[model samples]
Target: MKADPQAQRRLLDLQAIDTALAQLAHRRRTLPEHAELDTLARELSALEDERVRAQVAVDDLDRDIARLERDIDQVRARKDKDQDRLTAGSGPARELEALQHELASLTRRQTELEDAELELMEQRETAQAALDQVTGRIDSTRQRRAEVEQTRERTLAEIASEEQFKTSARAPLANDLPADLVALYDKIRENSGGLAAALLRAGRCGGCRLELSATERGRIKAADPAEVVRCEDCRRIMVRTAESGL
Candidate 1:
């Protein structure tokens, strides 16, 4: 397409800006902070689940201890009443003998309750330890999460500022170029992984880094200024200048 050389050069500048912007966007997406945040989030979730389970275990042990205490109390009270009856002379020998036997059974029952209480205490302590560990992990994860968030925000802001600068820099070229040409440039940029225009620098194509033959350079120089020329190596639109050393 016929376009002023200056306008074409401006287009190249716009292309370069857009290419840099794309790289910035890709970097932002692949930032380590993003992965770090994800890892922190997963760790936090697992810690929360573990904490909850530990708390539940502690609660269950508490209930079990309470129930065992109540049982022991009831059994001891019954044994005390039986002993009182036997000592008060209010029962026959057989009845007193039965009361003593009941008291011995109550003692065994109390021992069992005590053992259960001990086990429950141990379980409670273990649960508490697990809870503490999980809480510590949660705190650490939260701190890391905050750090990741801050880093992500900062990086995003920098990228935004850079993109804004590139957008403003491309503004001057937008008015002079036709919409169809701009679309074509954008398509080529997408297909070329963000490089749409390349400078013919030092007799070489900047995009492909391949030297242009003398005959090819002569033909490129002889072409009309309005004519757009492509590099033989990469097929990218080539913008020539004195720096090209053709």
Candidate 2:
């Protein structure tokens, strides 16, 4: 392919811009915040599960404590009623003796119920502590996630702005070039990892960093100024300058 000598030189500028754009895209994809968010998401999910389990345990203990309190209250009420009847002394001796025995039994039952209630209250306290700890961890994880997301958004915005600038600069330069030359560059770039041209400096193929053999140098030296030369090794356009040592 043939392109004006100056137009070919401009290809280098276009390549630099394109390379910068590619680097920006890579940075965007591999931002540290992205990985951090993923890790935090997993941690938050696990913490949420733990919080659910803790809350369920706390709720179950609450129900048990409430039930025990009701039982203790009923037992105390029965004991009170029995004491009141005995104090009245309105029944026969046999009946009064039975009432006294029944009051003793009711007292024992009340004590047992109160003891059980106390144990349940302790368990509820422990369960509540566990739930609080889990909830605290959840809040912390969510806060971290929000911070990371903010950082990620800021980084993306910066990348996008830089990309826009590079893109704007590239359009006019690319548009001014010969259509065939730009088409060729695009094709090579697509296949060569975004590198379509390189300077031939110090008798070396800049794209591959390989020295040109004597015969290859001689051929390129004989070629016309407007001729597009591709490196034998890397197949990229070799843009020659005074420093090329051709």
Candidate 3:
């Protein structure tokens, strides 16, 4: 594809814009906040699971305590009735003695039940503290996520604006160049690592930085100035400049 010598130079400007656009796209994908947010989200899920387990632990303890309390109430009521029967003095000696012994047993059983309830209450307290800690951590993480999301959005907006600016900057240059040349460059760049044109500086292909042979230099020198020249090794469209040493 032949183009004016000046148009070949414009390809450099287009490449610079294209390179910036590519860098911007990469920056968008690799934003640090996105990774951090994802990590926090996973941690929050784990915390939620811990909280549920802790809650279940607390619930079980509560049920145990309630059963113990009911047992204590029944024992106390039985002891009261037996004590009243002993005081009434209507039973035989053996029956009264048996009633006294039963009352003693009931007292001991109540103490045991009360001790068990107390132990379980302590366990519940500890479990509740753990639950609070997990919930607090979850809340803290969610707060941080909100903050990071805002920052990420701000970063995205800045990138979007910069992309718009670069796109606007590239529009006229791309529009001013020959359609066929731009199309060819686009097609090649798709498979050429976003670099379709290379400056032939110091008898070297700027894309690959390999020096051209004397024969290659001779051919380029003999070619028409308007004819498109390509690098022998890199296959990039070569553009000559004052510093190109062509």
Candidate 4:
């Protein structure tokens, strides 16, 4: 394919910009924030599960404590009502003796209920403390996740901005080249790992980093300036310049 020598040199600039873009893409994939965010996400999921479970436990304990308190209150109410009846003295001696005996049993029952209520209250407190811990961890982890996500977003935006600039810069250079040549370059870039052209510097293919043979160098030296040349080893467009020693 025929291309002006100056236009051919611009292929190197295109290659440079493309290389920068590729590097930026790779950088986006390998950002430390990505891994950190992944880790944070996993941690947040586990913490959320734990927080939910702990909250359920705390709720269960609260219900138990409430039930125990109600039972103790009922027992106290029964005892109080019996004491009122005893004070009224509305019964004979035999009935009064029976009432006194029943009052003693009610007092014991109230003590037992109070003991059970205390145990439930202690359990509720413990469960509530555990729930608080899990909730705190969840909050902190969510905050960290947000921060890492923000950092990842900023990094991606920076890379995207640079890529846009390079793409815009490449537009006119690509437009100046022959359409067929640009098409060939694009195809080669796809097939050759994003490299369609390389500098033939100091009797070498910069793409493959392989030295040119003396006969190959002489052939390229004598070739027409407008004739497109390719690296023999890698088949990349070999662009000549003052530094190319061609």
For TM-score, the strongest prediction is 2
RMSD values, in order shown: 2.3, 1.3, 1.7, 1.9
Q: Can you tell me which runs of candidate 4 are displaced by over 4 Å? A: none
Clashing pairs in 3: none
Query: Candidate 1 lDDT, tens digit per residue, 152-215?
Result: 9999999999988888877777766877667767787788878888888998998888999999
lDDT (0 to 1) per candidate:
0.84, 0.93, 0.92, 0.88
How many residue pairs clash in model 2?
0
| Candidate topping lDDT | 2
Model 4 gets an lDDT of 0.88
As for TM-score, the candidate ahead, 1 or 4, is 4
How do these models rank on lDDT, best leading?
Answer: 2, 3, 4, 1
Residue 107's lDDT in candidate 1: 88
Ranking by TM-score: 2, 3, 4, 1
Candidate 3 on 1-246: residue-level lDDT in tens?
A: 799999999998999999999999999999999899999989999999998998999899899999999999999999999999999988799999999999999999999999999999999999889889988998999999999999999999999999999999999999999999899888878878999888889988888899999999999988898888988887789998877787
Models 1 onward score TM values of 0.88, 0.96, 0.93, 0.91
- Between candidates 1 and 3, name the one with more favorable lDDT: 3
Q: Whole-model lDDT for model 2 versus the true structure?
A: 0.93
Off by over 4 Å in 1: 177-183
**lDDT value, residue 84 of candidate 1:** 87
